[model samples]
Target: MDLTVIWAFIIAFAVFAYVVMDGFDLGIGVLFPTFAVGPERDRAMNSIAPVWDGNETWLVLGGGGLFAAFPLAYAVILPATYPLIIAMLLGLVFRGVAFEYRWRDPGHRRAWDFAFSAGSLVAALAQGMTLGALLQGIRVTGRAYAGSWWDWLTPYTLLVGLGTVAGYALLGAAWLVWKLDGAGQAHARRLARGAALATLALLGLVSLYNVALRPEYAERWLTAPTLWYALPVPVVTALAGLALLRALGRDTHAQPFFLALALFALGMAGIGVTIWPNVVPPSLTIWQAAAPHRSQVFMLVGVALTLPLILAYTAWSYWVFRGKVGGDGYH
Candidate 1:
């Protein structure tokens, strides 16, 4: 068996899970200011309060997996995008503090709310820029990153950052639509409509930019052979976007959120198609970046034993917290 390939998939799954699980809550934080204060904002917070922290578990797994299973990639990628990573970490920390203190200190709730929104927005943008920086390809020499500190601060990266913000806001709006009812749901539906339009527009721009930015990506999508693998992603994504718009317009609750998730899944698939086999991109393949075979096998054993338990408990938590979140709490 190709242990390197297995580890690659494991890390990909971990990152995807982190994005899917944490994206909406971050989106909620991004859209927090738009909601009416008091009950509306409180309900939005209540909806995600139970699962938000749990969602970050996948992030730890993804980062740690990279360090252990693909040390070379970790070593190179970190230096290439250190500023963005630090920004992301700081945003998470501040938002986490704001999340807890808002409840404990009602007198300064407004300030906490601002901190939460700003932190979440910064984190989301930083994460997206980090992705863009990676996709734009890192400068590597020998076994290390040879890029300057500001290599990540390009126009293309900024566009991706904006797109990420729009995408997360859409997810947040869809989530609120799913989890709230009455006036809050109606408001969320309105927000979702705007967010949907913005997200789809940005997704198209980002896709086109991606093609123009890298010949490899363009060849993958426009040429033969790999073209077959690449074609369905955008087509299916468009269909999903249409369905999401339709769901938002109707009386449906859960469908919009799931469709939004479908869009994210398609985005991830597009990324996989773009950068397959290369963990650091441009040059380094998974096999070249991976740790020793014995180490991989050992890590796989631990993951095999622990992953199921994590999945089980995550599923159990969601099940336990199922249904709408109202003014007071879950109903």
Candidate 2:
């Protein structure tokens, strides 16, 4: 198998894992406003406490894979979206600090609560805007970033930022369905319904923007044979979204959360398929962005050995902490 192909997909896997795992914790933070300051909010925090750190672990792997496998692309992507990238990291730092301090002292719990929610909001929006910028296209000229700093700040990307907030909120609310009971569960279901609707609407707008506005994306998607394979991605996303909407009314817990996750996965897959071979938009192919072949060959071994263990450890951690958040949160 081609090492370039292998590494490219490896990077994709890492990114997907990060989004799904961290997405929920981010969602939980986003859902902070929905709950009042009390045991309910405490329960919501505890629901994600055990896994939030673990969820962020994918970031290192994903970014590392990109830097190592496709140095040129990584080089360009960072500089092009530096402000958003810095915002994301800074927001995460604030969120992490709030999580730790919120538990240690109750005197200023409200302050910490604000920090956590604000941090989540900033991080989610920045990350979403980064995604939008990438989808819109990175200005790459012969292995260097050629776009202005403001290039990433477009109306469509900002729209994507808003949509991402709703999407993650959906996941967070669905998680609440799985973990909370009584009023919490009911509130989460309501949030899920609203979030799903927003997501559906944003999905339509994004599709229209990509198809009608971005000619390259439209050309590839409409004209290429790959459309046949890629069509199922959106179909699966729609089915999952619809199923999740339906399941939210039922008594099922994990089903709604799982289906929501499937929706995220399928949407990502659709984007991946649509932009295959191009590491960046406007004709930057993977091979062109790839690092030295020797570097790729050497890293493959480490990836094969390391990735599964990390995934297994993550799985085991989740299994150990499985079930609802009962028993008086945080001692």
Top-scoring candidate (TM-score):
1
- Candidate 1's displacement at residue 171, Å, is 1.2
TM-score of candidate 1 on Cα atoms, chains taken together = 0.98
Quickly count the clashes in candidate 1.
0
lDDT of 2 by residue, 1-331 (tens): 7989989889988998898888888988998977978888999999898889988889999998999999988999999899999999999999999999998989999999999999999999999999999888988777699989899999989998988888888888989888888787888889888988998889778877887656778876677586777677777777777788889878888898888888888878778866777988867999999999899989998999998999899999888888888738641
Q: Show the lowest summed lDDT stretch of 10 residues, model 1.
A: 322-331
Give the deviation of candidate 1 from the true structure as CA RMSD: 0.9
- Report lDDT (Cα) of residue 67, candidate 2: 93
Clash count of each predicted structure: 0, 0
Instruction: Candidate 2: list runs displaced more than 4 Å.
Output: none
lDDT top scorer: 1
Screening candidate 1 with a backbone cut-off below 3 angstroms (N, C-alpha, C), the clashing residue pairs are none
Q: 1-331, model 1: which lDDT tens digit per residue? A: 8999999999999998899889999999999999888888999999999999999999999999999999999999999899999999999999999999999999999999999999999999999999999999998999999989999999999998998898899999999898999999999999999999998998899899989988998999899999997999999999999999999999999999999989998999999999998998899999999999999999999999999998999999999988999778665
